[model samples]
Target: GAGVSQSPSNKVTEKGKDVELRCDPISGHTALYWYRQSLGQGLEFLIYFQGNSAPDKSGLPSDRFSAERTGGSVSTLTIQRTQQEDSAVYLCASSLGTSGGQETQYFGPGTRLLVL
Candidate 1:
């Protein structure tokens, strides 16, 4: 079985530019999550998708951030106008179930975004 994976291990962009980050969750996993880790800050939940349910976007920092999961497998996080403060490691995780019980989340290596 494959684990969660992310693309473009590193990205460098000018402020105000747009960037798209991709993630592929393990096959058959029904729950997926996106998180961000800024310098000197802990990991923050960004968004989540479970099965065919509407995504939870409450964790998104602002209107500039958005994401979508296609076919309940691959997901993409899009930043409309990148900012210096948006520089961070974007991580993706997947779990077998959505309940907050015994399911364990597997994380990807993360995509590092650097907005200049």
Candidate 2:
């Protein structure tokens, strides 16, 4: 992919449904990250993976949220039993592989999820 691509730019679900959002990161990049941005909040870091290895899980909100990256490229975020409080924008970013050498991340357009 040229840049990061996310599916279903917008999603609306009821209070107790499951939703899966997809992301296809730029080819060859290895550092992938997930973040959540609410209506009036800063981007909250969720998880970060470096080539299939998730070294950070410090931000997942609850047991209902989970994600994974495979082959160091595509990733998916799944929310189970969604709630109104979960309504927000889910963003994905990828970099040219992360280590002590990497500096920044490239962002995707984001998936707007509305839990009603």
Candidate 3:
């Protein structure tokens, strides 16, 4: 892929139902990240995967929220038992793993999750 891509730009689900969002990262990029943006809020780091290294799961908000990056490329974010507060835009980005945050990240058009 030339750029990061996310599926179903807008999703509306009933409260308590689970949802699975997908992210496809750019080719050759080693670092993939998932973030959440609440209404008018900053991006909250959810999870990070850099190459073959053990995934950095420190940012996951709760056990209900989880993600996995397979083959060091694509990723999926699963929100189990979604709540009203869990509604937000889920964003994915990719960057060179070794560089610090100073490097510009390529971001996908985020998936908007709405829990009704």
lDDT of 2 by residue, 1-116 (tens): 49998988999999999999999988888788899999989999998888856558789999999988766678999999999999999999888874645467889999999999
Model 2 ranges off by over 4 Å: 99-102
In terms of TM-score, the best-performing candidate is 1
How are the candidates ranked when ordered by lDDT, highest leading?
Answer: 1, 3, 2
Candidate 3 or 2, higher lDDT:
3
How does model 2 score by TM-score? 0.93
TM-score of each: 0.96, 0.93, 0.94
How well is each residue in 79-111 modelled by candidate 1, as lDDT tens digits?
Answer: 988999999999999998657558899999999
Candidate 1 Cα misplacement greater than 4 A, ranges: none
CA-only RMSD, every prediction: 1.0, 1.5, 1.2
Task: List pairs with backbone clashes in candidate 3.
Answer: none
The ten-residue window of minimal lDDT in model 2 covers 97-106
- List of clashing residue pairs for candidate 1: none
CA lDDT of 9 in candidate 1?
A: 99
